[model samples]
Target: MKSKKEKGIKYFLKKLGPGNHYPKAILYLMLVFSIPATVLNIGSDIAGMGAVSNLLIPAIPSFVFSIVFTTVLTITIIKFSYQQIAGILKWLCLSVLLYIIVPFFIKVNWMDVLKHTFIPTIKFDQDYIEILVALLGTTISPYLFFWQATMEAEDVKHKIKAVVVDKQMLRDVKTDVNTGMFASNLVMFFIILTTGIVLHGNIKDISTVDQAAKALEPVVGKLSYVCFAIGVLGTGFLAIPILAGSLSYIIAETFDWKQGLDKHFGEAKGFYITIVISLAIGLVINLTGINPMKTLVYTSILYGVTAPVMIAVILHVCNNKKVMKGHTNSLLSNILGFITLIVMTVSAVMLIYFSLHH
Candidate 1:
């Protein structure tokens, strides 16, 4: 059996053999949907910060300038090591706590929040279903699976010496993933809470940067607004490179091109160029007058639609003893994975059904 040292999503797929092309095709479909969606997501973040800039400082010109400036800034940052990027992201992620604080400043009915959160309300309307799918896509994106697998491989690759993969390592992986998910969902919850409480009736939709920043105004006056704006800028700065890098990795792995953040630009020109080209395309997208907020929604929906197939492939690989080398998924893991797959699959189906009927 092959050692699992260099394991990745592609590696597992390859285990299916050279003739079975379904997994590879699914990856290709992911790339098709992901590249444009990621670019729009990056654009939305930039536009978000631009909205903040306009609100706080009138002299900063338009969001277009913001897009150009951010693109240049991100290109410089992507050259850093994965560790360096993670260090930066650690701080940027703290900005999400700002949302958690916002709800405290306003009058919030905790009981209602909890009720809606736990019990929830389901809607079958086209618009509601569409947004639901988008939410699923954003939260459980397909590219993230590839990114996680590649990053794990990179982690193993970067070790100075060979390390044993034991039960301890598996525990660490689970802990890391669980913690990150908790943090992600925590941020999402607070964001929705703040938005629903403050902007629900006042702003029907957040189609612009100004509307986005306004969600923080009630926290502690302009100070909160400024901090929130800076946080959005920080997050955008953090997310773009990761998004670009994920796209590059997907393409590089598919083609067997040289890749890795640790490699010098000259050593991995194709890999580096893929990142640049994707970012450049994203920059061009911002200039096309597409609604950044709308672009984000559409991007999420695309991810949602593509995620079910990817999840199915992942579940297959996780249970295959030949691929895992006897380290198959625990029952709990399989249960949760199936639950996610079912939810995403059903949401995608409902989105399609509503789109056709309505």
Candidate 2:
């Protein structure tokens, strides 16, 4: 029996092989930490700092149970908002969701954590605002915007809905974008809250994808490793389509081609081709043995540095009578937006100064 089990393991390993690193990592994550592992994690948490733990283990199962509950609630909120969007405005809501911090599942004393977050953090460093803004900017990424626009075009090209968009349609597009933005920010906020409480600055400066994945252990326990993989994979599922779509959109728009996803491949050859090329480039970037993470850091810095100009573009477009019409940004939105923009400026400066010093 032991020999058979060993053979089974060998067969599976051979099937996965070493070249398939990503899947292997994911498989390892599952074997090392599943429901049983999560149960063990409860024991790890039980040996916690006692009463002050993030969420009082009202019972060990409470923490586990909450995951299912929280997931349903989160999905429900997103679904309701999606339906509420006048049109594609859900996309803007999504962008806002992205801007918010990521929720780390390893939270203790949940009520208190939420309470502390509401109570403004009083770190008065000059770069504080900038850092926060930079973090927010990371959520509604530029690449995502371009990607969505292209996908919209693809949708139109297909006889999926035999209607060409009029000026009326453009307004719907803007609403969709705005709604996506909101959703994006909201999601990010939760991430920050969750991780902030769980890790409490236990680890900093993620240099590699592995480091980022490993950092989740303190928050999620033994499954920390697996949770990290799941989260990244989930994000990648959302991200890859956008990465490919955005490139296709840019190419189609610049060339005035009738490119679209809804269209059959024969109808939108250029569009589909562009998406393939974009993905291929990304694959090459990953394969060249260059640290894609280093590229991310530098790209992040670029995002920070260019934030002011991007904010100006958004503000001008959103506020313009000619563009936004009646749907122009509310005064509250503008105020908060500018505040965040100023913060981004400060952060960019700090990043530059730090880069020079280090």
> Per-residue CA lDDT of candidate 1, range 112-191, in tens?
88889989788779999898999899898877887787776666556424444557666777788889999889989887
What's model 1's lDDT at 297?
84
Superposed model 1: Cα runs more than 4 Å off: 1-23
lDDT of each: 0.75, 0.47
Per-residue lDDT tens digits for candidate 2, residues 297-337, read 34444455654655665566677765444667889989988
**What TM-score, computed on C-alpha atoms, does each candidate reach?**
0.88, 0.57
TM-score computed on alpha carbons, candidate 1: 0.88
